[model samples]
Target: MEVSKKNKLNKIVKEIETCQACNLCKNRIKSVVSRGNENAKIILIGEAPGKLENEIGKPFVGKSGQQLNDLLSKVGFNPEQDIYFCNVVKCRPVRNNKDRKPNKQEIEACVKYLNAQIEIVKPEIIILCGNTAKKIFKINKPLKMVHGSCIDYKGIKLIPVYHPRASIIDEVKFNDLKKVKKLRG
Candidate 1:
């Protein structure tokens, strides 16, 4: 079953690499696919690829990635071995030669890839790591009000959390992670 999942995910990754569903693809150096164990029970979904992530073709490789790694480590989770990381939009959104937030149309165009990933991974818990992810999921409430709470969405558990790139207040993030860990376990 795990092998099948990996195979399907690999095929999806290839599709994402060649994807021209949105204009973001035009400016991308590489489609940031995903990272971590394919069979992970926990999946972390961020808004989209940032500058460093776009440069490296890996999601969450910038300072935000480092912060996420540190937080995961502090919480006793191994990013590479325990959890999967991805972004709602695989390609970086660029405007005026600078990284910009993905627009609604762009996100709409790119969401199929993320949905494919969710179907393939079949994670028990999805950590929506920011407002964009929350918005995509139709989680309209502010992150502050729901960051540590879990919601059941179509038989899968969803947890909204602050984006790692957001203000780095360790205590707040840690508390949210604790809630996720508890819910995951």
Candidate 2:
């Protein structure tokens, strides 16, 4: 099963590497595929690759990734074995060397790749990090209201949580992660 999962993921990665479905592909250093266990039970979907992620050729790394790591560890989740990380869009959306949220066209172009990752990973839980997943999933409520709530999406457990960018873990996020941990029980 693990071999099958890796094979499928690698096929998707190859497709993402040559993707030119949108303008975002033109300036990318590399198509940030994914990071973490391919056989993980949780799929963490972020907005898009950032500058560091693009440079390093990995999804969800650097400071925000560090914050996520610490949070997950605090909640007794092993970042490596428990979760798989990817983004809404595989390429970094940049303008003036500044990273930006994926626009509608960019997101649309990459939707197939993202869907393929989810299908291949087949995680038990999908953690929607930040507004991107909220928008993609059509959750109208703001992150403040929706962050940490487990909702039934396509019969899968979907939890919307703030994308960790801050250095400190606040009460709500910490508590939310604790709740999310229970979902894996």
Worst 10 residues of 2 by lDDT: 165-174
**Candidate 1 TM-score, true structure as reference:** 0.95
User: For residue 95, what is the lDDT in candidate 1?
Assistant: 80
Q: What is the lDDT of residue 79 in candidate 2?
A: 87
Q: What's the CA error at residue 12 for candidate 1, in Å?
A: 0.9
Query: Model 1: C-alpha RMSD to truth?
Result: 1.5
lDDT by residue for model 1 (1-185), tens: 35688788889888988999988888888889899998999999998898888889999899989999999888878889889999989999888878788999999998988998998888999999999998988999899899978898989889999988788588899888888887766
The lDDT for every candidate, in the order shown, is 0.89, 0.87
lDDT of 1: 0.89
**TM-score for model 2?**
0.94
Candidate 2 residues 88-152, lDDT tens each? Answer: 99898988989888899889888898888888888889999888877888898988888889898
In terms of lDDT, the poorest run of 10 residues in model 1 is 1-10
- Model 2 ranges off by over 4 Å: 1-3, 166-169
Q: Would you list the clashing residue pairs of candidate 1?
A: none
